[model samples]
Target: MSTLEIKDLHVSIDTEQGTKEILKGVTLTIKTGETHAIMGPNGSGKSTLASTIAGHPRYNVTSGSILLDGEDVLEMGVDERARAGLFLAMQYPVEVPGVTMTNFLRTAKTAIDGEAPSLRHWTKDVKAAMENLKIDADFANRNVNEGFSGGEKKRVEILQMELFKPKFAVLDETDSGLDVDALKVVSDGVNRAAEQNEMGTLLITHYTRILRYIKPDFVHVFVDGRIAEQGGPELADQLEDEGYDRFLVKA
Candidate 1:
């Protein structure tokens, strides 16, 4: 079984003058087929945590270990980590002006999976995933995220996730700026991908409404760059009722 283990992880971004720390000794674990929700307010190092795990070159891991199925992911490069079955759905997907969605997805599929998809099945699969996510069929022909709505961008990420079928996925604030209907569509895409692949996920978000649909197996309260509390599905209920105020006090 695939498992992602973070042990006393620390991350910092560099500046010309000196270094600044973001993630301070954070530790967590996600086993195969488990859905773990991490809740934190802004600047709590949530995105930093996800970026660090995916081996983002800009963020440096000062001290800690990232293990995938008992292997050290820190030793691997970004592509290596991705090919090893770790996926990050970024909070902000980049806009690739000249790269069409179909081309981008196909290239990523080929590079990570080590085989280009056959034309016969590739077109069919792409269309089916778009249909599932309610993305227009023409989205495939557009530049990657160049003219997408917030919801469309999230769905594009999920589409890549679906194509990759990574063993572990970290979804960063997939619920942001989405309308009720768009929210359902995005949540459904994530659910479908997880159910189809038994993919372990770490969903980072502020609102609990998404949880109403996704139903996390575990909910963690992150504050001051570390997890202050963690529990079963009930924790999400508590957050929904009380909010993060008590968590700040506890932290």
Candidate 2:
């Protein structure tokens, strides 16, 4: 089994005012086939952790290490990190105006695998995945995420994950802006990837609503850039009832 390890990670970013530390000495590990949920209040560095893992340049690693199977993740470029089997589904997916979804998917698949997929099998796979995600066939010809609703954008993100089959997926508030039906569809896609590929997940969210669909093996409460508590699925249930009020008070 592959392992993604974060050891004493401290990340910061420069804002208009000054350089602000977002993650303070945070550490965690994820193994393929495990699902870890990070629930927290706004501005608690959960997204920063996700972005850092994806190698976003905006977040600087002031200290600590991110390792995938003992290889230094922090040393890799963003595309290099993705080729290493790390994926991030952004909360607000950006629109790619000039790129068609079909071309984009195939090109990305080729880049990640270091070889182009056979035309016949690639077409079949793309069609099946889009259908399963309930995305319209015409979207294959449309520009990536352009003019799509929030739910549609999120669905496309999952489509990428399902196709890419990354070793670990960092989903940053994927359930946000999705309706109950859309939520189920997205959650099912994530579960399918985990079951089929043994993909580990680091799910970041604020509410327990998504937890009802994507069951997590571990729940971590993030407060003030640190994990305040960790527990099993029951911890999510407790958060649903008690909320992060106590954690905020302590922070």
- Estimate the TM-score of every prediction: 0.96, 0.99
Clashing pairs in 2: none
**Alpha-carbon shift of residue 55 in model 1 (angstroms):** 1.3
Candidate with best TM-score: 2
> TM-score for model 1?
0.96
> Candidate 2, TM-score vs. the true structure?
0.99
What does the lDDT come to for candidate 2? 0.96
lDDT, candidate 1, 1-251, per-residue tens: 67899999988999897998888888898987899999987788888888988988899888999999999999999999889999999898888999999898999989998989898899999999889888899999999999897878988998899888999999999888889998898888888878889999999998899998898999988888888889998998888888889878877
Q: List the lowest-lDDT window of 10 residues for candidate 2.
A: 74-83
Residue 194 displacement in candidate 2 (angstroms): 0.4
lDDT of 1 at 193: 77
Clashing pairs in 1: none
Q: In model 1, where do residues sit more than 4 Å from their true spots?
A: none
lDDT for residue 37 in candidate 1, whole number 0-100: 96
